[model samples]
Target chain A: EAGVTQSPTHLIKTRGQQATLRCSPISGHTSVYWYQQALGLGLQFLLWYDEGEERNRGNFPPRFSGRQFPNYSSELNVNALELEDSALYLCASSLVYEQYFGPGTRLTVT
Target chain B: EDQVTQSPEALRLQEGESSSLNCSYTVSGLRGLFWYRQDPGKGPEFLFTLYSAGEEKEKERLKATLTKKESFLHITAPKPEDSATYLCAVQAVFHAGKSTFGDGTTLTVKP
Candidate 1:
């Protein structure tokens, strides 16, 4: 079986621009999660989507939003990006308690 | 609010030396704790999951043990390949799918 897959291995965006990242969960997995791995900041939870519904979110602002699709794939959107938003965005798909992550999309905002 | 903390931001050991990393957490209701190994510029790789205290899991030279307040990742006869950041995360029963993670412990094993 294939693992989680994410699009755009690397992304470069400017301040005030919007960026969208995508994720495709593994087969038979319905729970998808998004996380921000900022340098030195650790892996911070961003959003969780289960069965096409937004489950829970972290302490991040509203600019960070995402959605899950019918097929269990997901997308993360960042509006009015800031320089501090430059970080690796990771998408993970889970089966109950066990979770697996994708290679991550490196977002660099100038 | 739930909190997770990992000790000794960094660790360096010889190929045959053994050591342990620590992860301490405080949550209203502990549902489960997870361990992940992450290489530079890569996503975290799942290692183990411990749901209750006194539970233990092992893979190769790495062993993970859980307790009420903390978890320890013990590395024995580690190789340079074991060098990477080890992350600890916890899920609170109240928070549902949200997981609180620590900054992580970066380990470096010399040949």
Candidate 2:
């Protein structure tokens, strides 16, 4: 079976713009999670979507949001992006316990 | 609040060296502890998951053991390819779908 897959391995956006990152979960996976790995910030949870509903969210601002589709794919959207938004956005999918991660999308805000 | 702390922010070892990394956690109830390896420009790759204290798992030259309040990743005989950042995370029963991750320990293995 294919592992988690992410689109546009790298992305570049200007300040105040918007960015979108996509993720396709593995077959039979129902939960999709989004995380941001910023410099010296460690890995910060952004959002969690399960069964196409927003199950839970992190402490990030409203400008950071995401959604999961019927097919178990997810999209992470960053609005009003700031230079601090530059980081590697990771997507993971799991059933309940273990989470498998994708290659991640490297977002660079200029 | 649930928290995960990893020790020795960095480590260096020669090939065939044996060492271990530590992960200490504070959670109301630990549902699972996860270990992952991440390269410089890629996302993390799952290594192992320990459910309860005294549980252990091994693969290749790596062995992961969990205790009541912490976990240890032991590398029997490491290689240069093992050089990467090892991250530890914990899922708390009360947190539901969220996880707390440590800053990670950067390991460097030289030939």
DockQ of each: 0.86, 0.83
TM-score per prediction, in order, is: 0.98, 0.98
Q: Over the stretch B1-111, how does candidate 1's per-residue lDDT look in tens digits?
A: 999999889999999999999999999989999999999999999999999999999999999999999999999999999999999999999998888899999999999
Quality of candidate 1 docking, DockQ: 0.86
What TM-score quantifies how close candidate 1 is to the native fold? Answer: 0.98
- Weakest 10 consecutive residues, lDDT, candidate 1 chain A? A91-100
lDDT per residue (tens digit) for residues A1-110 in model 2: 89999999999999999999999999999999999999776899889899999988899999998889999999999999999999999999998778899999999999
Deviation in Å, model 1, residue B18 alpha carbon: 0.5
- Model 1, docking class: high
Candidate 2 residue lDDT tens string, B22-110:
99999998899999999998889999999999999999999999999999999988999999999999998988788789999999999
Global lDDT of each model?
0.95, 0.94
